[model samples]
Target: MAGRFDGQVAIVTGGARGLGLAIARRLAAEGAAVVIWDLDLTGFDADKTSFRPASAVKVDVTVPEAVTAAMDDVRSSFGRIDVMVNNAGITGPVAPVEQYRLEDWLRVLALDLTAVFLCCRACIPHMKAQGYGRIVNVASIGGKEPVPGICAYGAAKAGVIGFTKSIARELAGSGVLANCIAPAMVETALLGQMTPRFVEESRNKIPLGRFITAEEVAAAAAFAASPECSFATGFTFDVSGGRATY
Candidate 1:
């Protein structure tokens, strides 16, 4: 289990902090040279960041051009991209669907959902070229069990699940494998986007009676990105703390 990603390169979007950061740290600990993509660099100081053999890149995952250029830079600097962890996402303001602003809705989808598509589009070619790769997308239990207030977040995540499944089928014949982790509520910075009532309600829904930890989600992510995850593609590994019904 140790050094499962030895001598490999991993790209983790939104990895400056929170769950993405935890996942990046786990990957690096497993010997993958991790490239963390984030809009903010303040928290990514390699010396201060909780990881080794890792670098931080400022790239907007929501932008195709930025993603492509960043990937090129990673390829040029690191030589190859063996693992891709599309962990970038957001939960827009918690509001009723009708009350949600159009602009906010678009923004949520742009980053939470569309960004995954763009990152995957940019990374898939590189992975295909390598003839071997692992893709671990970070989805949410909200995608399956939609909450009432956060329509944008839930819808975007549902799209991610669908996209992951489709791409998994497309790449199954190839060397690259794709899968996603659908986690229940995790205590992370993104929680700021949700209302207090919503958060409390969500916690109550978890059969385990508690929120998931970022490290727990990261552990699942590490496995999805490992070489041993060969048999399952397009699979949704649940980190729902008993919240997931299916």
Candidate 2:
């Protein structure tokens, strides 16, 4: 039996670990030839070894040349890009706005917001030419309901949600769809940046009483990137454990 993504070529940014890894694994399992883009390749071999259709390339998504070159390499290797998951991000400087370092705020915005813009800019032409594509951006619940002590992270993610929506509108006639997943407090390495007190407070606010799981985030991403997702571009899927009731 053929999988949902059989013969598709998928690119997952920040796929070396965390939620990105889960998204990459899911896409590969569904039969897409998965190309991972990340700065750190540590533990990346595990995915390559476990999934026959998976590979990784070193990329700094914040760098336009790097992102373009990496996408070119992916095109050269796989011939076409059918799916693009913008899953790379960082939670920078978990501190009050008054105490936040300017550099850290800038870094978070670069990775979490600007990188999404760059990835979309680079991949859109290929997708438009191919007449098909799916773009899934990983946003955050904090984006919808800004969290204190992580204002920079929240602002960047909020920008991502808006960016995806705007692009979806622009690409509506191009056969390329763009959507995003806004998830709450997923138990990934990003959590390391938060204090225990912050984590507990976040969990308490969630009606479900817990942080989201990486696999859960991946599942939503997969749906957004699948062909069945037709008719639903520029949408934000909330996996915030009831925290994002809107």
Candidate 3:
């Protein structure tokens, strides 16, 4: 069957599990030949699904050299990168600002903020040259509102939102669109890093009375990276499920 992404190539970061994995699968199902960049590739086999990534390359997104090399490899193999999903992230030690460790803060920012920069930096040129591209950064509702204990996470995601806007404007007429998803508390493995009390409190705050799902996020991301998303750049698509009043 023909699909929106037929004959296109996509690259999803941190796709070994959780949100990244779900998004990767969704892109593949839509007929985009996908590539996964992660530290682990155990989840994606050559025949895992009717549509799967052409290659699941092991990558450490925090490292500049590795990200550059991986991006280059994908371009060399596919001739173009139509979609770049910066979905790799970590919620560093969920604690108050005063209790957060310096290392934890830096680590979270490195993976969450800086890695997004690295991937976008590597992809912008290829996209510009082709005159088309979609960069969907997975931000968080915590970035827009206050999530209290997860100071580092909130800060990093806020940066992603701002960064997406900046780049979207920069590439506005250049044929590349940049946007982000600000979803509320998603019950993924990432939740395992948070305190049970913290999780409970977060769930209670949601007006919908439930957390987000990986599949829901994936669907939103797919739209942001689709040709139909042509007019909505520099925007934050709220997947907060009624939690965000703004």
Candidate 4:
């Protein structure tokens, strides 16, 4: 049987590790050509050899020029980009809005929100030309519900949700589709930064009584990027492990 992404070319930002890495591995395993754009290029060297059509490039998503250059490099190498996953993000210091530092807040916003805009801007034209594309953005459950002590991260992710919907509407007639995924407390390296108390508290809040796995989030991402996703643009898929109810 053929793979779901056979012959497809995909760009996965922040794919060096965590949820992004999981998504990249899935896509590549399914026969898609995968280009991983990440600031940390370590350990990914092995990925190039293991994945048939895979390459890793170091990139800071906040820089528009760098993002554009990476996109161009992927286009030159792969001929065309069939999918783009905006998964680069940062969780700034957890604090109340009043205590949040401006610089930190801006940094989080730049990476979590502005970077998505930059990647989408660079990739939409290519998708439009091909008359087919999939854009899967990694938002957070915090985007929909209020999360204390992480205002900046929540706000940025919320913006991603709104931006994705708008773009999906704009490209409604086009073959491209845009969607967002909101995962709650996934087990990743990033979660290590949270305090033990916070982690335990979060676990308690989840009806499942456990954290979601990165692979679960990757499954949702694959679905969004698959050809079957044609009818669902601007939609938000929740991977909160029952933590979020709507």
Candidate 5:
């Protein structure tokens, strides 16, 4: 699997850092010409990376126009989009449903669920035209387990899982596969948003008694977004450290 992506083009949304960055790096290492889409380019340093990406474009995935423009840029520059990793998202305020604000909920879904949809909608045509593609959407364990105090985040991620399932069904026998990754609180900047108690309680829930790492997630994503993963679609690759068994 060393050069699983050689001669292919891959796009990683919100890939400037954290889980996205890790996945982007892995795809590049496997020989994919990786391109990242993010509002911030602070964490993406081409020269400092082990596997330098083809480019990092500043695109706000939440905006349909921006996403379309960026996809065009990628296609114009790289020729084809072989893989798309929807990794951009945020863990909305850690508050109970009763305390959650409507604005916060809207914001969460806009980036988490809606953005995934927009990116998929924008790229599927390109992939369909080429007759081959792999779509790996980053979901969360909160979508599987009923985690309280984060209604928006949980609901949005659940939507991603459901959305991915439908995408796979629609693309069946179409040379394109869609899957999701449900990770249980990986130790990335995502943790910084949570309260100390929130992080510890989540850790205790995992039988492994620890949070998963970004590199571990990247490894799993590499396979899901690789051509080697040809048979599985509408599946969830869990990196929950025993928090989720199904």
Candidate 6:
């Protein structure tokens, strides 16, 4: 039997590691030609047997020109763009709002929020022309609720939710669907940087009492990108291990 995403083409930003890598792997396993876009090119193995040799492209999503060039390259190589996962993001500094530096805050916003806009702006036109597209953006539980010590990261993710909703409405008539996923304290390398106390606190707060695996998030992403995900644009899927009741 053929995979669900057979013949589809997908681009996953920050696909080198963490949640992005898991999503890329899942999409590829489902028979989509996958392009792993990231800044760090070291040891980034794109499983060629699963997808179309898994193109590994170095891209900084915050830079519009770079994003355009990367997308163009994907288009040229893949022949069509069917799905995009905006998963590149950074948690800058852990500080109170009063102690947050302007530069640090700006950097977080640029990467976490602005880059999503840039990618969507560059890719939506092609998707519109084809009359089919699926966009899955990675936000966080902090986007919906309060998360202290990471104000900039939280705010940027919240912006992603709003931006995705607006664009989802605009493109609903054109056969392109946009959605965002909000996960809380998933098991990624980035989580290692969190203070032990914070980690423990987060785990305790989760009703499941455990950190969500990257594969869990990947499953949600795959569903959102699937053709069966019709009539669900502008929605937010929660993968917060029951931490988010909304």
lDDT of 5 at 106: 97
lDDT of 5 by residue, 57-127 (tens): 89999999999999999999989999999999999889878889999999999999999999999999999
Across residues 1-246, which tens digit of lDDT does each residue of candidate 4 receive?
Answer: 239999999999998888888888889887788888999877665535344337888999999899999998888888999999999888878777899999999999999999999999999999999999999999998898857888999999999999999999999989999999999888988877777777788788788888889889988999999997878999999998787776
lDDT score, candidate 1, position 6: 94
The alpha-carbon deviation from the true structure for residue 189 of candidate 6, after best TM-score superposition, in angstroms, is: 0.4
TM-score of 6: 0.96
Clashing pairs in 6: none
Question: Which of 4 and 5 is the better model by TM-score?
Answer: 5
Global lDDT of each model?
Answer: 0.90, 0.90, 0.91, 0.89, 0.93, 0.90
Enumerate residue pairs that collide in model 1: none
**lDDT tens per residue, model 3, 93-130:** 87778988999989999999999999999999999999
Clashing pairs in 2: none
The deviation in Å at residue 83 for candidate 2 is: 0.6
Residue 62, model 4, lDDT: 92
**Runs with alpha carbons beyond 4 Å of true place in candidate 2:** 47-49
How far does residue 3 in candidate 3 sit from its true spot (Å)? 0.4
2 versus 4: better TM-score goes to: 2
Candidate 2 lDDT tens digits, 146-221: 9788989989999999999899999998999999999998988887887889889999999999888988998899
Which 10-residue window in model 2 sums to the lowest lDDT? 45-54
What would the per-residue lDDT of candidate 1 be over residues 87-204, giving only the tens digit for each residue? 8888889888789999999998999889999988988998999899999989999998889988999999999899999999999878899999999999998778778888899899
Q: Which of the two candidates, 5 or 6, achieves a greater lDDT against the reference?
A: 5
> Cα lDDT of model 2 overall?
0.90
Task: Answer with 1 or 6, whichever has the higher TM-score.
Answer: 1
